[model samples]
Target: MNAGIPAAARELTDRLGPDAVATSGPLYDRTRRVWNGAVTNRPALVVHARGTADVQAAVRAARDHGLPLSVRGGGHDWLGRGVRDGALVIDLAGMRRVEVDAQAAVATVDGGATAADLIGAASPHGLSAVTGTVGAVGVAGLTLGGGYGLLNGRFGLALDNLLAADVVLADGRAVTADADHEAELFWAIRGGGGNFGVVTSMRHRLHRADPILAGTIFYPLPQAAAVLDRLNEVLSAAPDELTVAIAMLTGPGGAPGLGLLPAWSGDPAPGEAHIDRLRRLGSPAFAKVGPTTYSDLLHANDEQGETIGHHVACRTRSVPHLTPDTVSALVKAAATFTSPLSRVLCGQFHGAAARVPVESTAFGLRRNHIMATIISWWPPGDAEPHQTWADAVSEALARDALPGGYPNGLSPDDTTQIADAYGPNATRLRAAKTRYDPSNTFTATPLP
Candidate 1:
């Protein structure tokens, strides 16, 4: 037995079993891996928690040992808060369990379950969970930071669909948070990062959205300005069922180009009308707007073979409008950026997400807008160029954007923007942090 393993972990060795406690070798390396390959964290120990009881044990052990702690769900976060350099990581990947109550239209998902797991379970019953663009993203991390996805325009964000959550706090107390029970903690968890506790399970309200018309349209760089204007107009008046996401990239043969994905989650008749209009907005190099599943659309975002395991940095902003200046800036940035692996996406935010009152929940930014992400990726040793390029593009596009970026998009260095991320609900989040975690045991990110 390695004495390097903390004594606190030794206390629960029998209860959690040897396989659950990893300190070295391949298993330890596996537990340490996260979606972003750039995150290099070697924790003192990794606890592969199988249930809430195991989570409580890990929390108590960390607290008793006076060790800093972090939680790992899907480990897909850009900040890589899931597994830190020296903290003990509570690995929930083993606890992935998805239960669907079709009659009630709710999915009770374990924290470790990825977006793919939840969607695969719910789709069989013709119901769908509003998930992030990536299928590998952790449900807990995404929900806690206010999830955005293809269905967001129609059904609202993943946090907006969240009905309840089972949380294990720093003190080993497990509680179910919802509208009535532990309401403050519930509010805090909606947009607050995992500062208060570790969520064991989340009950999300599901929508009856399954197969829909969704695909991408590609056009030359010169046409992006008019196409973006038409898109702004179409989305400004379009119903909740139709959501459009646009990406600017260096297309085939290294030409500046644009790709758009219009996802409509309603009857084919009205949706076809909208898709036709969206297709006609620009002269395209190619177009493939057609019928498919939301799950398929989720994977389409990753079609370029660009994902975790690649050195990548992303910066995002929420813009009120695609003002001419913003459009020109985006075009110029795309034209100037040299990496083929990098991409810039502009997705519409409206319908239910926009109607939710700003103060009703912890997801503070309620206005209708464009959520833009500047993604940069490269090989291991050559990260500076990509990161610097992405930041420059983001800086250009952010002139007319809101002050705060999405919590999920914030990098590890962006602790100062926590208030902006929570907006009007920052005070409540701080108080809830005090009430639930006075000692601030979950130090992965800035408190409140």
Candidate 2:
């Protein structure tokens, strides 16, 4: 072991006690790396915080040591902002706590809780919140970055349901940020990533629907443009209760396919009518749609799957309308998905996501349906070609964008590119940051 690590370990162990810190062997290394390799970092220490008290200690220690602080939730960060060289990464993975209030129709989740965790907690109450499609993605980062999900159109974003947040600021003081308390911080937390403070807990509003009719419908790649064209027409008139995301990709067996992840938050009868628009698109390679709980919906794709090499890079845009030329560009990109290792995705992002006013929070671009995210996935060695392919496609679509980026989906290279995503909201965010986190010590993933 390095002499430096042992010293740091001893110092931390003395302050936080043995159970709260780890610097021996693989433990530190495992927590240092995130989902994205292109932006990997190595931290000097990792504090496996068990609760809010541990989080406060980690923050104070980082400040005292003059170390860069990286607050990690699920560690599913695509930009690898969860860890940094010579920094102190406060790992919240051990603080997962989900509390559901059936009568109040709300769920208070610890920062470490994943989307799957919240979904499971809300299932027994017959309620759900808008969460990321990937089950392992953390609720804190996702909600902070303006979470987009199957229920987004109907119930609003994960942040829209965010009632309050309990956080530990950069100075190590613990406080709550919400509508009535620290109002500006509350606005920032809704869509702003973890720039102001380290959130230890969050309380989210929940929807009252149960056994949501949800699942994906996969079509052959040939129908990519046609289905998107049809989706635009139907979604424009469809009620907010129905939310669907479209993806053009190569499925499990190296086959190019177009898929739709649909979730209905309304009655099953009307859901059938709305779903008919998709069922009639064309003969899908496979179709699976049914009434399922939020827990089932969250785990539907891979309920039994383990955390593996799930790497994805995405580009987002809020288009005015899907033009024929735009559709052509999308089809051209989809055609490039000839390789089984990579693919393009065109997900719908509107309704409740857009229903909120742009000035309501730090998040911008709330009024567009097609949030085209070109994602490519592969094993470690093949990331170069896969990401290159995804980047090329994203660049092509940026021409039709309305500006503003999803904080959670950002790549490390896109750190400076976030301004474009914020559009008019950029000025306000900077001013807020200047007032709150002036020194920018908390600059983490998708650095604003």
Candidate 3:
């Protein structure tokens, strides 16, 4: 143990109230370990902020003591940036709150709320948020870093629907940033991530996304190439209401196969028509397609089955088209899956998501393109083989894929290529950083 941990913990508790402070104890270890079982970084203290005032106090303490501050919002990020050695963690899990304004078609979510929380709150109103494949992911992290979701084709990325946010800067001031106030920060957080400040709450526009036609269509390994060709054709010509994530994995039966998971947000009749066309693409070994709620679609891929104690890493590349060469390369990569839970996931950024301008937000890529990710997960003591396979897949795809990468799907090796992540927004994002966080207060992740 550190010689000064007790004194530091005592001073934090005295200033911030014991109820909201946690020191070196079982409780502290438990809190730090809850998020990512793979993250072993132990912070000196954890400030469990119950509200905005608590966040402000924690920020002041970090500034006063010159200690690094880690903002733990939902703490579901794959990178495990929530905890760091010798830092102070501002834990926001106690702040889960979501409110829906049906009349205005908007939903307000606290920084700590997960996508599942927001979906549950908004679904009763017959409205929905543009959330990702997993419902349990933190809304703040997903939205801020370009949320690709089932409804992305219909509405846009989650950040595109964000209207405003209440943020606490490095200097300890709580302020509102939106289109009308603190405009630069608003633009920055849309995709620049948690570099500007610690967000307290966020307001997002909602959409009518009920009665969706969503499910999976599985095909034999021999049909992968043909099915991908058909997938490329259908998604390119399909209406904005349709989006699909096609996965290649070793199924429960231990055989290589392809699964086309589609989501249609338009009227049921047309949605079924599109699904029918997709169903006819290849001779399927199995299929499950029918009516389902958008919320259910969001939770379909929640990684609850994978024990958190396993090492999880990911690599991604965006390509202009699912060319026959690209599809073959990806299928070949999936053959190297190290665990039953590991596989390749492919999707596209088109329709409403593609229409948004690159300059509109800090997200780098804004064109219609297909993306493939190698999700490599392995047990506690065997990350080498899985990570090596993922790296090989990444290098293989980079040859035919575009230059840029998706922030949420990038691995440690890929994120270091920051130019590919932020693109043209790099200059402006750094300028805004110079003005708002010159000292680089938020250093947990890759920032411009």
Candidate 4:
């Protein structure tokens, strides 16, 4: 055991054996890093949990020793909540196992499973799970927060598809939460995030995996305002099967442009008409709409995200409608990007996702709106300018934006944003947090 670690952490290493615990050295270094390169928090001990029992033990150890506790699923959180300074991390990286029940249309996914893992398993069975645009993100984390994706129009958000979850609570007790059992905890976990406990596994409802028309269409930067205006009009009456996400990004030859990514989950016959309508929005520099597999579509997004550099700063806003002012603000922000890697992404929330009653789950803002993500990134140097640019863009759009932001994208220190995001559900969520985790041992996304 490494003498540098706390005695409580060292005791945990002794019980789990050397392979399962990393007090220091190369293993600890490798497991400490998250998706965001800017985060450099180091845990006192990294417990590589392989199953539910291992997680239970880690929670017990952290509670008994009075050490801060954090859980690492896919370790893709932009905020890097998985690894905290001087905390004991229950690293679930080794627990990625996915089992699909084709007949029941449910997949049992381990806590560590990524969107790719679940997609790969379900696609083989001619099924698909609602996941975020990026495949590398953790399924548990995404579902615990509100998961937004192309399929959300046909299905609902990822949390809406969550059928059940196996959670290790603050007291180290294992329990299964679903609609029929521990209903309140079930509601809280749907959108309350990982505040209640460490989720070891989850059961997600899967939909039929059918090839649909999906791809991107890019337009010149000069025509962004017009394109956005037309896009807002088109989305107002868009069918439930079609979902489109708009991005102001640097395109080929490092030229700033507007890109629209559209996915249709229903029959391709009618989807062709919808694609054609979007194609005529503006004079496109490039378009690649066609019938493609969901897995391939997700892989394409993963490849695109990989190019945005390691260090990143992101801000988000929920706009009820893409008014002319909102469009102008986004275009202006894109024009003055601090780095070529900076971009503004907006995803529409509607159809099935919007139809769910607000009180049905803990997720706030159920009405149709656009979730704008302002992101800036650089190489490995200072990130002050990039962060400033993102924050400024967020402020500019605040006039036309909603009160709250996306919980998954918000930072822990954003107290006001957190309160706004939870809205009326804040009271019940706080009660659930107090009931299930009074000591606040697990802190994933900041609670309202």
Best by TM-score: 4
Candidate 1's TM-score: 0.95
What is candidate 4's lDDT per residue for 1-448, written digit by digit as tens?
A: 2343577667777788778888689989888887778888888889999999889889998888778889988777777889988888988889899999999999999999999999999998889999988888889999999998898888989999999999999999999999999999999999999999999999999998568689999998999999899888889899899999989999876989899999999989899999999989989999999999889888988988874337878888999988888998899888888888889998889999999999889998899999998888777897888888998899889889888899888996777788899867889999999999999887888777
lDDT for 264 in candidate 4 is: 93
What are the per-model C-alpha RMSD values against the true structure? Answer: 2.0, 2.5, 1.9, 1.7
Better of 2 and 4 by lDDT: 4
Distance from true location, Cα of 371 in model 4, Å = 0.5
Residue 80, candidate 3: Cα error in Å is 1.1
Model 2 clashing residue pairs (backbone) = 354-366, 404-421, 405-421
Per-residue lDDT value at 107 in model 4: 97
The positional error of residue 411 in candidate 4, measured at the CA in angstroms, is 1.4
Q: Which of the predicted structures, 1 or 2, would earn the higher TM-score when compared with the native?
A: 1
Candidate 1: tens digits of C-alpha lDDT, residues 97-185: 99999999999999899898998889889888888877878888888877877788888888999999999999999999999999988
Over 4 Å off in model 4, which ranges? 1-5, 307-309
Q: Give every collision pair in model 1.
A: none
Question: Alpha carbon lDDT of residue 372, candidate 1?
Answer: 87
For candidate 4, the per-residue lDDT at 438 reads 99
Local distance difference test scores for all models: 0.82, 0.75, 0.82, 0.89
| lDDT of model 2 at position 208 | 81
| Model 3: colliding residue pairs | none
